[model samples]
Target: MNSAVTSRTLARTDSVRPFKAGAYGFVLLGIGHLALSAAAATATQTSERRAVDTVMRESTFALLGLERTVLDVFNGMSIAMAFFSITCGLLILAAVRHAPALVQRRTAFGWCALAVSLAVLVVSVLLLPPPPIVVLTVTSCAFGLSLRRATTVSAHAAEAA
Candidate 1:
């Protein structure tokens, strides 16, 4: 009898096309985040140094090695945030694939991960310059909304019977 109910639940879940699409979307977003992050880590350091050089060219503290200090500090933070973003994306992808029940119950986890990614990107706009704002924002918001809808459907299904 329990097995029958479980089968019924799975059948109902199968009809949720959005959930499947959202899972795929999360996977793609995760891959994009990882790839872009790697690109930034490898190629952008010189650009970042150039920007710092431009900004500090007129400042007196150029004599105190302030430009190099700023570059080091901000570069370290940017690298750390990039790694964190990639890890969060990967976690979302993994959870959607291997742990749907956990995803449903702890929907906040997914939301928080997306939110953090958005927040970091938004900050990067000012500090790092020309980060992929639109892609990250849209993908994060869409994935978060889809995950929320999935959990809601699951809840409604449970309450209906």
Candidate 2:
């Protein structure tokens, strides 16, 4: 690309600052979650964890007419959540790169992300340990900052117009 185009691209990328933080937070946390979940699932279990694993593996419940062990259900949920978090991050990155103007204008995408992040943060606080809780806290905060910045820019543009 020409220098002019390259410069414009770099400038555009630079403009949406806080969105980057939130997007990377979601992406990185999802990766960490996936890695930790897989490691914990596979790592040599301690006595207590082994006992719980046995119960989880042995215990069965019917859902949608299918029987599933607690272990199976829990693992499935963990994988699903990892994918969802990664997708949310990718979507935000796409929005930031491909539709910066729309992002600044304040869209449903931003609102949904903020809401989902906060909801996850709350759940993490209640159920998970410090690491996930801290990640969610930062993710939610970055999302909130990005959205608030977008709202301010939109308001200023409106006033100027």
Candidate 3:
């Protein structure tokens, strides 16, 4: 409540804002991805066998080759998305560990990076055409927004100082 203590607290808060936002974003993104993977696995295991059999019976390999190619493209996209998500997660971890200090300095940059990363992730998930991936993308967007808000608050506080 004292001026000195208040100032110190504000300063500290500002310093860690971005890092905390990044961390939260990463955690959310990771959880979303894991959830998506689990759901996809479950759907594939439970519902796809009959459909796959039907497709196999009716479809020739040459025709199926196109399906395979499409799937291959999706697989590559999924892999890339996963990699980017992981990288974002790592950055979040770094931010969390360092907190306000890391956040204060790179708030804008961090936000931009997360926004782009999330955009790419969403596109990748859409390309895969998985319900779970879509869910993950939505959840990740929510988290990313939350982080952005937090960083903004922290930046404002810092500027006030």
Candidate 4:
């Protein structure tokens, strides 16, 4: 290749890799959140089943006054929330991976992911414990900051050249 073309190509590649890495980091973060949510849902479902069984066997409908309807609703809500969290994770991964042109915009995406994760953490505190979600949130934020820094450095280098 000609010198000018070669240099330009190299510059583009240099700018691209960090963004790709950042995108993959988001994917990993999503996967981590999905796994954690699934684990929590399973544990919660199992516990609910046990409670139902205990109530049925012990005939404590009056003492504890736990109704099947209430248990079912709670279980359904938990499962629904888990499903929504998984869907959001998948969507974030897909969005970043499919749109390479948006590499420069990855910082914004990362921030969004981090914000959502924080919101999830707050909700988890009110409802359930989610240490894994917190971990993933921090991880996503780091990747985002890395992407922004790399992009800024590349832009400066390109300007100097």
Candidate 5:
């Protein structure tokens, strides 16, 4: 899941599409990301990862006057990323509950989501594997389709009004 979408895709607009997409899709993805990270952290390491961990532990680097190993930095970064994703997801969900008057108007909410998801999709495709790439692709399409439908509905409303 893209942190940018979890953090920035939701706007204060009155759009249920935002709520449904963010709550159903993005929030679930965030939780899944955190769960997967926790699982990986606890699962027995593969030989490749174990070897890397050994080498990483052997080397020490100074950061802020404290000595840290590569493994320390790597683990810290991974945990932080997972924490950030779940945090954003929970926050968005909270917003959905507390803010009930979010189904009357529309804004660029989906555009923001689509943009960030697309960018993340590209990066995932280039650097990561298929799982993340597929997630991003699905998210991008959701946002785009939601945005299109929202616009079409609102446009008809404008005509009727």
Candidate 6:
């Protein structure tokens, strides 16, 4: 019932809420990235199969060009995205374990990382297969949320100090 105890409790609660939100947001972003990669992989396989069929029917090697090269790059990128997503997820899990301690000091770094990731997501969506717009959108939103939460938590922690 002491005022000091109540203030401490409130401060702790407020500090934790943003960290929790940011951690979950990062996790969701990772999951969405993984899903996008999986979908891209499937689409790439299908397209490759179709290309083989067309080549067989036409009996020509004339289908090689910039478009084909771009598709191949996109295919490779899907694998890269899968790895990135898993890595981000693990990092977020670690942050969750450490909570305020880990996230509090790295708020700026986290924001920068999220911004870069969002930019990559946008570029990938533009250059890659088309059906996973929802995945990209969700991932973007989650990263934005994570950045917002990190900023809020960092500001609150500074004020408390």
Q: Which candidate is the best by TM-score?
A: 2
lDDT of 2 by residue, 1-161 (tens): 55554343333323267667878888988899899998987898899998998999999999799999999999898899888888878888987889886556567777787798899889988989898788878878877776766754557577889
Name model 3 segments beyond 4 Å from true. Answer: 1-18, 44-68, 95-100, 106-108, 117-161
In order, the Cα lDDT scores of the candidates are 0.54, 0.79, 0.55, 0.54, 0.64, 0.55
lDDT of 4: 0.54
Query: Residue 157 of model 5: what lDDT?
Result: 76
Residue 100, candidate 4: how far off, in angstroms?
2.7
Stretches off by above 4 angstroms in model 4 are 1-68, 106-108, 125-127, 143-147, 150-161
Off by over 4 Å in 6: 1-48, 52-76, 102-106, 129-132, 150-161
Worst 10 residues of 4 by lDDT: 6-15
**Tens-digit lDDT track of model 3 for 9-70:** 34433434444444455556556666676576567464566676555455533454454444
lDDT of 2 at 46: 92
User: What is the C-alpha lDDT profile of model 5 across 1-161, one tens digit per residue?
Assistant: 65555455554333555545643555555666678878888999999988988999999999789999998998887667656656655665565466533323335444555677788779878987676677667777766655544534456578789
Best by lDDT: 2
Instruction: Give the root-mean-square deviation of each candidate in angstroms.
Output: 8.4, 5.7, 7.5, 8.5, 10.6, 7.5
| Tens digit per residue, CA lDDT, model 6, 1-161 | 65554443334323334544444544565566667667754674676678865564554332455334444554556567656755765676576576654444446645654575577568758875543445455545654554444435546677889
Q: Work out the TM-score per prediction.
A: 0.51, 0.81, 0.45, 0.47, 0.66, 0.48
For residue 38, what is the lDDT in candidate 4?
A: 67
Q: Which residue pairs clash in candidate 1?
A: none
lDDT of 3: 0.55
